[model samples]
Target: MVFGFLKKRRREEIRAQPFPAEWLAIIERNVPMYARLSEADRDELLRRVLVFVDEKNFEGAGGLEMTDEVRVTIAAQACILLLRLDDDDYYPALKSIVVYPAAYTVPRKESEGGIVREDDAVHLGESWGHGAVVLSWTSARRGAADPRDGKNVILHEFAHQLDQEDGAADGTPELDRLAFYAPWARVLSEHYLALRTAARTGRKTLLDQYGATNEAEFFAVASECFFERPVQLRTRHPELYDELARYYGQDPAEGSASA
Candidate 1:
């Protein structure tokens, strides 16, 4: 309890410090979504970013050098997910971010007919239940630069972070109340099944086909589409979009219209 209070006090101090000019310039230049946010939301996001950057340990791997630009750019995108959430701990389960210069490869194991095969798989980002997120800086930057692409590695991985907060990545994060779960499960499951059918039939989809992998992936992928392609998601999948908007406490489609 004492340690928690100290951490909270430290976070308050960090939040009180003025946001640096260079960080604002980086957000303006790298994250297009920043321009679309209302001034109040922008200020709130900046406060979250400050605490996020201060609390999380950032390390560069695969020959990349860590810098303020990399840290602030990633923090801004990650904190956008928390802008309206009632949580004060930020990502309580997250401890560090590991960034690579570009896409990196990890070992993959596949089992077919009772035989297990190991191979290398390339990835842009991954979120672990053990309090770490790995990202490729190149992909992260691209996602931030093209806010309408419906694919942001930082957002996707951080969504997984949210999903893991309750000690499980079952496509459901910690909702504000127990009452919110039924609707959330119903809507997301409907869309998940639809996406799976669409993927099997080679039909085009607004939400990423990768979401069909499972419920956890569906939530993360849906989160990416929620913020990046809000207008399209709202138009095509109103039910799915509504669930996300209710959970996130923001209407990006409305923001898009005003923008």
Candidate 2:
């Protein structure tokens, strides 16, 4: 109990700290969505970013150097997920962020017809259930730079973080109400199946086809489109869009309309 109290106190202090002007500049310059957020949401996001950066350790990998630019830029994007949550714990399971200068390779094993093939597979970012997120700096910057492209590595991996918080990465995060489970499952399942059918049929999709891999990836990909291409997501997949907007508590399509 004492430790918990102390940790809460420390976070309160961190939240009270004056947000650095340079950090705000970094968000303004790197995150296009920052400008689209309402003033109050912007303030909340900045506070979340402050606490997120303070709590999560960041390390450079592959001979890359970590800087305020990298940390703040990454933190801003990650914390965007926490905005408006009723009980935001700032990704309690996430302990560290490891960033490579560019895409990195990891060993992979693929089984085809009972034969397993081993090789190195390139990845832009990966979210682990064990409590770490690894990212490629180049992909992260590019995702942030062109928010409308409907791809954001930080958003994608961090959405995985949210999905894992419930001890599973099954497309459903910890919803604010138990009642949300039914619709969330129905809508996301329908969309996930649609995406799979679309992929098989080579139909164009608003969401990245990568989501068709699994429910977890579907959630992550949907989150990217939720924030980056809200208007289209709403128009093309309104049920899917409504589920995400309800879970996120942000109607990004409304923001786009007002913008």
Candidate 3:
């Protein structure tokens, strides 16, 4: 009861404030993906972003700093994912978004006490436990500007969050009902294994090799493709595309066509 009241009160506080008009303009102009949503959906999404930006705590790391531009920029992109699915309400689970100036490295240990850093490896975004999203400003802008290339930092990170919500990044999120799980497992398993095998054999495929890392990554990478390259993903891996369609309850290719 106490937590619910606190959340309600906080939302009320945010509802009273206004978001920057310039940021909303940016979202509409830069993200054609957002333009596909209905006007009502767009209004609701902007409202959600308004509250979402207010709800989460943002940390600017690696010399980055938080500003309304940063918050609105990130929030608009993140909220775009919710425009088409059940993602919005659950996103409060992620309370912090750590933004770096560019693609920051998560250093790994090398053999024989050697340190190696690959500065050119740029990851646009990542999401972490307790509702944290990390992103690079440059990639974020480019991603929103062009959604057709099957690469989106915000969608990519939020896909990670969806996988993590069930307490494991196991290439699955909690389904609406138990019945949905059987087909989900069946289709995802088949496609996941195929992609994994293809990755090893160096076969050409639509999904990125990063998906080969695990089921979690498979879900995230596939999700990036699912939204950005909907027609391509649907054609390349129809079963996986169908399962994601069932799960997300939206079809981007279909949606885009109607638009």
In terms of lDDT, which candidate is strongest? 1
Better of 1 and 3 by lDDT: 1
What's the ranking of the predictions by lDDT, best on top? 1, 2, 3
Note the clash tally of each candidate: 0, 0, 1
Give per-residue CA lDDT, model 2, range 1-259, as digits (tens).
9988998899889988999999999999999899889999999899889999988999999999999999999999998877877655789899999999999999999999999999999999999999899999999999999989999999999999999998998999999889999999999999999999999999999999999999999999999999999999999999999999999889988888888
Q: What is each predicted model's overall lDDT from 0 to 1?
A: 0.95, 0.94, 0.78
Error of 2 at 164 (Å): 0.5
Error of 2 at 74 (Å): 0.7
81 Cα displacement, candidate 3 (Å): 2.5
Clashing pairs in 3: 94-131
What would you estimate as the lDDT of candidate 2? 0.94
What candidate 1 gets wrong by more than 4 Å, as runs, is none
Give me the displacement of residue 180 in model 3, in angstroms. 0.8
